[model samples]
Target: TGINYEVVALMAIKTELQDHYNVLDNWDINSVDPCSWRMVTCSSDGYVSALGLPSQRLSGKLSPGIGNLTRLQSVLLQNNAISGTIPSTIGRLGMLQTLDMSDNHLTGSIPTSLGDLKNLNYLKLNNNSLSGVLPESLATINGLALVDLSFNNLSGPVPKISARTFSIAGNSMICGVKSGVQPQQSMSRSHRIAIICGATVGSVAFVAIMVGMLLWWRHRRNQQIFFDVNDQYDPEVCLGHLKKYTFKELRASTNNFNSKNILGEGGYGIVYKGFLRDGSIVAVKRLKDYNAVGGEVQFQTEVEVISLAVHRNLLRLIGFCTTECERLLVYPYMPNGSVASQLREHINGKPALDWSRRKMIALGTARGLLYLHEQCDPKIIHRDVKASNVLLDEYFEAIVGDFGLAKLLDHQETHVTTAVRGTVGHIAPEYLSTGQSSEKTDVFGFGVLLVELITGQKALDFGRLANQKGGVLDLVKKLHQEKQLNMMVDKDLGSNYDRVELEEMVQVALLCTQYYPSHRPRMSEVIRMLEGDGLAEKWEASQNVDTPKSVSSELLPLKFTDFAGADESSVGLEAMELSGPR
Candidate 1:
């Protein structure tokens, strides 16, 4: 039964997706009923372009017949019990976008014939006992975006693609000249050496041809992610305009990253607050688990994918470090800390997050999320959106942070299957149940933070009234039942607020927390709502207009800090220990 009918059973999870399964109903490999389900996906020519049930929890070698899906774009099935060599005929899948066969107990070196797949974007063959000098031909394929060979018994100087971008973090025997952000002096020396060598050995046009070919190769590889054929990036583009820095330079600037330099910590990494010799401050992030449990390849891929992409709402990537095992990132330090700590919960035991301030923060955060989900090239899904992840600058401007679980999907793509990964109370119900994360997941998390801002409550509080709603649903229910909705307001505020604006915010919060993901508004729509529109026309019509901006400028330099009056050392690592009037 190796690579056979058992694979059909796995498809049974969703009745709609598996309805056409004909073979597994009878376990017959030769039956016509199983043909379509065996391996399927339609192509431009009205034919299947993908199929594979490798291991499929089956216990036998794959049949050579597996080669039938020549037009296939994806073949995935590993983490199963199966044996024997991979079919060299698999090289026929010229259109394959992804092929994974990792962790199966298989034998044999990878067939060099696989090099013929110029369109393949992803290949995984680690954990198998394959042996051979790794394929050099792979260096020629520009379409490949991911290649994994860490656990295999393979050897050879890793392919020498100039400044080869890869992660060999865990494999002790795997070695290569690891890349890093370098000084201009080294770059200048290499350029001089190359110029002298070229003067002695080659004519200008011949070198030009070689340079053009090298560029074309890079263009091909980038197509896997930046797949459009015509939008090639130029090597002369100014990276200096990005104004990034080196991690080593940052280390020296921050006293070798003293503990006192730590300003914040989140799911993705630790942020150390540093002041440059010239007195300019920055946040240096040394990724906590550079060798993340997920795998170092993914770590590098994440850095590459997110770094090059820019958005004003995103915390800018000042620079990065990849020397030895050091995987650090530097970003401009947001002087005001995170929104959770900045909101001055109480002023002399009274709420300092007045109606106006809370409203502004809400709108600011929505704009940032909107930019990520709706405006970027490949839309970004910010998997985490709690108050802690929303950082603020001196002006109380919000910026989204900690994009570890963020995904950059094709502009038309909507959701992807992933394991549940988010703080409790902030995760959407569907994500928790089905593991299908999407933009709406961020919406749910944002909704909870909205409540936290208004009520000064957290995402969840078990200490609340017994029988209270266990989550947002419960919070809404409790507020609805209590009748005195005013009681829900943060006590520190003590009604120095616009009741009309406050009610509208609560309604938006409720809309976001509804049981169905479809019910939540897109961040774009949320931005409009927060920008003083459509929540309650009846209220907005009679409500006083927003105060004129003339006097607000005087409010700048408001002298805000997590340790408002306390001196430096008082605000230490145990942030929760900081004592304040609130």
Candidate 2:
């Protein structure tokens, strides 16, 4: 159903721009020949490239049309009143170099696809109502020389552009050193002055003063290390005692933080393995100093919030230490390691967490997240939930970790973050479509985790080596379509597993993986479906859980527009065929 790569590219851009401009009325260019369009641009050989439609007053939802502009090098749709999101299709525009949508009434978060433009040097998003954090993915483009994000409602710390052409003027909430209005940076500078002035110098005392200041600074500056419990309590000011440690002490525990003790690597740092003096072992995360605009504040805020999280299923924070350059987080170590490790290792070498173990893990993880989402005072959203981050204790109970990107939402409402930072394949569809992260996003990742547990394959893998042509879900869908689902179960589970139980799990997983977030089940509902079908307990609770409930209004929204030709009520015969019961 896809057009030629070139036509697909052209259509994608036109569709996106049209949607942004509300210009999609009767837009039926059914063929691949975009050269015939009044709004399109083309090169000498008829290869579609560049789309320049300035101030068309185009209004409507952005179409997937932008994917039509394959050779498109520049898209200049500045000065329009377009009021929709940029489509995910635009990211497929591999050759796009300059995108100018400045001064448009475009609203919504910036697309992560824009980060796919490696050759992009000019990005003009100034004067729009674009809110949220700038995509750090865009920072991967070191060649970008011009970026005008001025006058937007952007917030959070900024990134240092290599070309130094980054502009953040007029954005009331935007913050960064390069943007010249970062409060945190200004505070650090003021603190530095205070330290230098108070600890004065003389020629003979100068050398000693410099050494003392350097050492003290090294001891004082805290990197946004993992959850350090001591940082939560200042014994001199606060009442309760906090588990605090100096950078030197942490360095000593991990043998000067040796590589041999590394637990895992992360977005802003590396997590090391360490043991406490009380005969307990822990995982310590060390923050890497990337570009400072977004890094330091994010680090600081992360440490502050995570220490306050107290839940049985939540990863416990042992402590943390901050030095001038080093930030380390100490966490109670899990004996079985991560879920991903178990999935990868040979069962004989390191026992593959069995299907039953995997289910309990998923259920426990859902409950943990549900507590974060519904139980916490300021409902927290675990933005980065995945198998790798889900640690397993000796009993295989999943403990969701990583609070660097965690967010606290107002009661009963969903939490939305600026930049979309999540693993591929696990990211929710709506998040990719609109940059809205909610409890639903975590739910989507949990759904993928469910599928992973069943199939023993990566969420996005095609698995050609396993003689499968698509992801595990794709294989499952194909099997259902081919009426061969019984054959699709993992070979490891022969007669040992009950067929009905497997079927039920697959159904729950499929519901979780629905294309839209609103369509997917909430974690609470998911728990019910898995534990016992509380929604419709009539479902067979066997391992196959094979019962598909009746299409109630809550279950599926089936409208005439969903089927082909059903909306053409006047066209009797075709409409009748389309309207027939599914």
Best by lDDT: 2
Candidate 1, 1-582: lDDT as tens digits: 455332333233212122232323433444433322322333324445444443335445655545555656656655555567777877777766567777777777777777777766567777777776656666666655567776776655566432233433444555453234333545577889998988867777788899999998777666654212222222221221234345556778778878888887666566788787778888888766656534555655565445433434457666555543456676778977777776654567655556777787787677667656644434578877887788876666667777734666654546754344566556665665555667888888788788778777554542143244233455564565566567677777776877777667776776665556666677756765665656665234323434223211111113322221232111102111221123
TM-score, one value per model: 0.50, 0.50
Q: State the number of backbone clashes in model 1.
A: 8
lDDT per residue (tens digit) for residues 235-268 in model 2: 2211012255766667767887798888877564
Residue 576 deviation, candidate 1, in Å? 33
Give the Cα lDDT of each candidate.
Answer: 0.58, 0.63
For candidate 1, what is the TM-score? 0.50
List where candidate 2 sits over 4 angstroms from the true fold.
1-241, 290-301, 346-351, 462-472, 481-483, 486-488, 535-582
For model 1, the stretches where C-alpha displacement exceeds 4 angstroms are 1-240, 293-312, 344-352, 462-469, 536-582
Task: Please list the Cα RMSD from the true structure of every candidate, rounded to 1 decimal place.
Answer: 19.6, 23.1
Q: Which ten residues in a row have the lowest lDDT in candidate 1?
A: 568-577
